[model samples]
Target: MRIEGKTFLVTGGASGLGAATVEALVGKGAVVVVADRNSDAGAALRQRYGSAIEFIQADVTSEDSIVKALDLAVGLSGTFSGVVSCAGVAPAERIFGRNGIHGLQSFRAAVDVNLVGTFNVLRVAADRLIKRDRTGGEEENGVIINTASVAAYDGQIGQVAYAASKGGVVALTLPAARELARHSIRVVTIAPGIMETPMLLAMPDEVRASLAATVPFPSRLGKPQEFASLVCHVIENPYLNGEVIRLDGAIRMAAK
Candidate 1:
């Protein structure tokens, strides 16, 4: 469970929470594989962290890319002890629109990225871990932390597509964990509320403040470091499996 001398794969490692997790792992003496769609961002991360990090350009929705990513993680460093699936898209749309129209393609795309994309990383990573060698550690052969959103449970009006995709992720956690238990790999999810990631950081200050104000306690956005810290804790603590931990601060979203 110790990160020292272990390896980890972080999908969507180019930016946002993924980037923060990568940095955190690296700081703890772990070698990291940064798999992301943006080659430039990956390159920049590599440059920032030097040789401790490896990167592969991959699309989470494609099986071929997932294969390449897993292979690269092993080939470039070695078998990974953990995987963090943070690759997701948050596209907003309603099932029926104001004009009585809906874009099916857009809805499907949201599902593809947020739902199916996460599963692609999960299944493939578990397969590789099942076949790889493990160090001596109780209930700690490997770990997978998936990213979900509070929207899955409390979706606002305009977030139908985004919410549905995230909901599927939340739904899959327990079953996935139960099935993978025998293999010594643990599965868990984190449903974050309002985080000051790039997506929200790009919004105006007033808009961001309004979003943070929705949180009843602390009344502010969650920090990416807080999420990363919990991930580290989950990895160290062996019994925290098959649970979806919400990182939202007492904030249950309302219908917008």
Candidate 2:
């Protein structure tokens, strides 16, 4: 699938990995629709890219909200071809802790935002792609990329909710791909480990360094641009479907 001249929708595109992806897509001559809850960041991005970027303040968990963003993307181009679901929340809590126990609402919030939110975008995007009219040489109608975390596999003691939510994302990749294959829509998930996102950046220097040291090689935190680069590759590589690719630098997280 050629990225140039194409239009894509990127959820959580206001910051972190999603922002990097928006930049990469625009740099590659693709128009991008940024769907995020951050209005300030959306304004900044729209200013940065001008007409190349269209931003909609969106809630990934709501189908109506996602539909508006999708409609905006399709409006920008004749048809929107792909979506990268990077909107997620990570909550740390133990099943039984000093706080007595994790709140059910918090657990539900994590799953609702991270897992269900991702599925919402996939389903809505798949529907739109399926209805699109394709031209010759268009082998695939669209691609759906989801964001998962390494915690899904090597969850630490306090990451029960976060891990379970991401674990669900990992579990859904293959099935989603298989179901969407007939529509020529690819589904893939990316599980990143210890990236330098805003949450980690707020930690003390020593703490950040300690986390970086956990990676076997590179010995540094992953960059959002690197993740964006991988996203571009995934979009271009037609064969990479129904797979969860770990973007970790050979790091297997230890139990905390």
Candidate 3:
């Protein structure tokens, strides 16, 4: 799909990877709606990007919230062409550990925000795309990109909830693509490793350095811009459907 003149909705667009994606998309001439729960950050983004971006405080786990975001996107650009779901929560807790058995609420929170949130955005976007009349000669209707994590494949000692939530995202890619094919909407997931998000950046220098060393080549934390670049590439590449691409720098995480 052409980036220029198209519209996209980005969940968690207030900061981190989602913020980078908003920048990239706007640079490419796409109108983007920033959907996030951080009102202050959303206001900040709006101030930075001006009218090129729209900010809507949204929660991806709520269907009503997602619908409002989608509505705002459509209002801005007539209709939106894609969505990049980046809203997620990472909770570190062992199943049985010093903290006692993991709380069911915590586990549910991870799954709800990470896995189910991704699905909520995708489903709502897919429905909207399916209902819209196809533009002549435009073979693709829309793209849905989900954010997973390397933890899905390499769950460490304290990542049971996070890993399971992300794992569900990894598992749903192909099926979503298959079902949505007839509507000309594609689904893809990106699993990033040790990204330099705010959480990681807040760590002590030595701890951050130790984590960066885990990556095999070009040993450093993955940049949010790099992930945004892949998102742009996936948006333009017509045949990259139903795949989960790893943005990790050949890092196979070790159990801690």
Candidate 4:
């Protein structure tokens, strides 16, 4: 499960948590395929990392798109050893909002991207990993790291769709790991609290500070690198499987 000399496919790797992971993995001598929809950012990453990384524009909601991305990973490197699914969207819309009832399309969109999209990548990557030769003494073939949210457990107001999608991710981890055990591929999910990603940075300074004050300790937002560090640990630790690790800074969000 060591990262050195291994290959990984990182979805939504052009920025935020995914970007940090791509950089961290490459720094450890692992070949990374950056799968994202942002061509400009992807190109920037390729330019920054050179041959250590490859950029593939992929839509996680589509099976064909993810399959093609996986194929590109094999073509770029030799085999796929890991996958990190970070492609997700969070839109806050109350079911009974002042504007109107939440749109059904919004709910479906979140679930499709966050939940179904994750499964799409997992199933395809697991299949490819299963076909590969086992490397470690533990017979480990691959690892899957999915991104969830603390909202899955403690969703606040205006997060009905977002919470449901993340809840599904948290719920899927154990069963996925159990089923994929025979193939020696591990599945794990990370439920992160408020983090200092691009999405959060867009908020006004006062708003961001208010959000930071919610964390009991550290009193600041989580950093993307911290999340990336945990991912590295999960990859190197074979026994760590089928579990959801919370990277929140002891923060339990309140209903807004």
lDDT of 2 at 15: 96
Model 1 alpha-carbon miss at residue 134, Å: 1.6
Per-residue lDDT of model 3, residues 143-205, tens digit only: 999999999999999899999999999999999999999888999999999998999999999
Provide the TM-score for each candidate, comma-separated.
0.96, 0.98, 0.98, 0.98
**In model 1, where do residues sit more than 4 Å from their true spots?**
none
Q: Which is better, 1 or 3, measured by lDDT?
A: 3
- Cα lDDT tens digits, model 1, 124-179, are 99998898877564456799999999999999998999999999999999999999
- Which residue runs of candidate 3 sit more than 4 Å off their true CA positions? none
RMSD of each: 1.3, 0.8, 0.9, 1.0
Model 3's TM-score against the true structure: 0.98
Q: Which 10 consecutive positions of candidate 2 have the poorest summed lDDT? A: 71-80
- Give Cα distance to truth, residue 203, candidate 4, Å: 1.0
**Model 3 worst lDDT window (10 residues):** 71-80
Question: Tens-digit lDDT track for model 4 on 1-256?
Answer: 7788888999999999999999999989899999999999999999999999999899999999999999888666555698999999989999998998999999999999999999999999998888876644646888999999999999999999999999999999999999999888899999999998999999999999999999988899999999999999999999999999998999988889
Model 4 residue 183 CA deviation in Å: 1.0
Better of 1 and 2 by TM-score: 2
